[model samples]
Target: MPPRAIICPHCGKIIAGDESACSWCGTARSHPWWRLLKPTRDTARTDWVAPALLAANVVFFAVSLILNFVSHSGSILTPGNNVLLLLGASGTIPIDRYGRIWSLVSANYLHGGVLHLLFNMLALRQIGPWVVREFGASRMFVIYTVGGVFGYWVSYVAGVPLTVGASASLCGLIGALLYFGKNRGGNYGNAVYREVSGWVMSIFIFGIIVPGVNNWGHGGGLVGGIAMGMLLGYNEKRKETPVHRALALACGVITVAVLLRALYGVFPG
Candidate 1:
């Protein structure tokens, strides 16, 4: 049989089949036979923003469940409740007849049901990473929280009472992505912009069809996202430095603290 050439799996450098070491990466030829095959896929890069955002949503949902169980407040409505919140019939409202207004921020994280939470998280998973990758995590967080609060406030002003969910925030992420794509305007940027625009259109259409979708919140979020994107440059232009990282970490910690407090309020020892 002819002698076969051995390659370093890590560096792809050629070596004698009998060689036991990779001259380039210093990786020992532990399995020469396996090295003969094509290289394995590279590990996926980590994105701090996406995972942190997902964790926040999941933690909030869990805390909401605990609140439901302990307080029996009936404020935590789930999808099984039949889109009651979507119809604007029920859910937390910032303004009540007595002129109380505190739900503006709190409503951003509340969901009407399992499906409501699922859909928002799905959108976040789809769009959150792109926003983080383009705008840096710190700016993305600001866009999410601020845009969400702003979107809800707009809905409130529009007289859409008792609205709640992360859809508005996710829409903001999409809007930001759209702005980034259009403003950046390279091959990839334009492509992303077009694709996200399609998503925005689809979402708008869906909102029209769905009985309880908050069109006002969606529009407000989109506008907010574009504004924020313009104010904060893309990740390529603005590096995610130590300060940005610190801010993101701080936001994550605050989110956790808020959920903990809510849980404690519901289930005090």
Candidate 2:
């Protein structure tokens, strides 16, 4: 005769006394026998866009350092007084003179010092993966590049001079995450939004207390990120599409082209 069956406590399923799991639903029978087994679940793995973005930032920094050395004998690149206006480092538009407006885009990859690079990259590592998972990689790239350009433009308009770094772009990523969390409208989402908002506020406060911190850039990047987030939406609104991949690729190409141009302009062999 067959053995009598018992139901699982967590998930209602019947199994024979000696069986470890339900034959119908695969629920583990939580008797002494099931207690001895390991737990497992089927979960989706996160995408690779965030790590790739971080790697790109690191590579850009390394290449910039090399170019700086070859160009001006300095270990890091700085805009020469002659080219400052052209390079968008001067923080002011030349009166009646035209230069590359695209420098706003290029400047996102440049950093002033080790601390600058460290802080920006750290922030990226912390917040970037979430953004990519929620919105996909391409949208995140758009938010980052456009947000950085907008932030730098604001600083320039405000008369802050000679700024360079990825902080503005990183700030944009934070902003996007904030918007995503808020728009989702749940305990989990609200909690995340609040936490990120606190981080943003703390950064602003620190900037106020510290000299040489560009609050304008930070504010502008945040605003840009929020705006882009509204336009692009969280993953709930759309699936990962080809548009995301294309935008990411475009941003990468633009970054590479800008670095090449900067190297050629500085070295001028």
What do the candidate models score in CA lDDT, each in turn?
0.65, 0.68
Candidate whose lDDT is highest: 2
Which candidate's TM-score is highest? 2
Tens-digit per-residue lDDT, 1-269, candidate 1: 63467655434467676666666545566754323222222111444666767776666666666655555545555522222222222223426552334344455666776778888888777677667656766878878876776787788778886677888888788888888778766544666776788898898889989898899898988888888778766665666677666765675565556555444544479
Candidate 1 scores a C-alpha RMSD against the true structure in Å of: 9.1
- Candidate 2 Cα misplacement greater than 4 A, ranges: 1-47, 63-90, 93-98
lDDT measured at residue 148 in model 1 versus the true structure, 0 to 100: 77
Clashing pairs in 2: none
